[model samples]
Target: MKIYALLFLVLCLSQQLHAKEIDVYAFCDASTKFLKKLSVLPLEDLVAVKSAIAASSSLEELSVASGVPYIDWIEDTQKQLLVSESDAKLIVFEQVKPIEFSRYSRVINMHGVKDHRLWDKVLNDCVSVNLAALID
Candidate 1:
């Protein structure tokens, strides 16, 4: 009985240890980039991104922002609608279901990797909107 219980515990722990990374963070990041390039985005999206960034004090974000006014403004204003969905539950592989990411983050590339070929495929399969067409 003791061995069976221990084995069960080990299996449970192993499963959790190997749980897949949630797409939420990746989705958020991609959405941020996509929205920034757009000339227009919903007010709610801007709110969410701003809220997330505001709530964080990471040196990485600070350094990434640099000192450009337009860049800073873009970072804040592009994520308005995406904010409302920020409270939704983050799903895992076991919960596979069609996800309608926020309008700001409508496009997603599921090919990101953390292995040796990572640099070769940064945003490899991500969608690229035509900013020129939208502006016209």
Candidate 2:
């Protein structure tokens, strides 16, 4: 009926209002301290960890390997929150497209992190474990 339709629309709008998103570029800039430290290492050493990252079966495993705790990464990006799912989807598409990243590990390593100074909130904490795995 008309009333049910109205209620459904209202619910959808409310969910959209509560939805959140992160800007990939901005997030990369925030940078985790752990990842910043890794950036200082020789590229070969960093590349050497690729196997460990790939072997990890879960985020917790990757977190342990990298010494970065697992947290709700996207939600933690308070600076780049987006209410619209469409915008978030577009951003994700732009960053992950043109090439296939079947695994999370591959995607995380391809995008170098940002952040030089060891700040209060390390990019490692706010990012997905896959990215953090490359830190150590």
Q: Pick the candidate with the highest TM-score.
A: 2
Model 1, 46-99: lDDT tens digits are: 455444444434324432322212232223223421432222112111111111
Candidate 2 lDDT by residue in tens digits, 1-136: 1222232222223234331332322444443333455555655655545555555555454555445442333222222554344444443333222111122233245335453433333333334432332232
Q: CA shift at 10, candidate 1, in angstroms? A: 52
List of clashing residue pairs for candidate 1: 44-80, 44-81, 45-79, 45-80, 45-81, 45-82, 46-79, 46-80, 47-80
**What lDDT score goes with residue 48 in model 2?**
48
Error of 2 at 18 (Å): 5.6
Clash totals for all candidate models? 9, 4
The CA lDDT at 1 in model 1 is: 18
Candidate 2 lands at a TM-score of 0.31
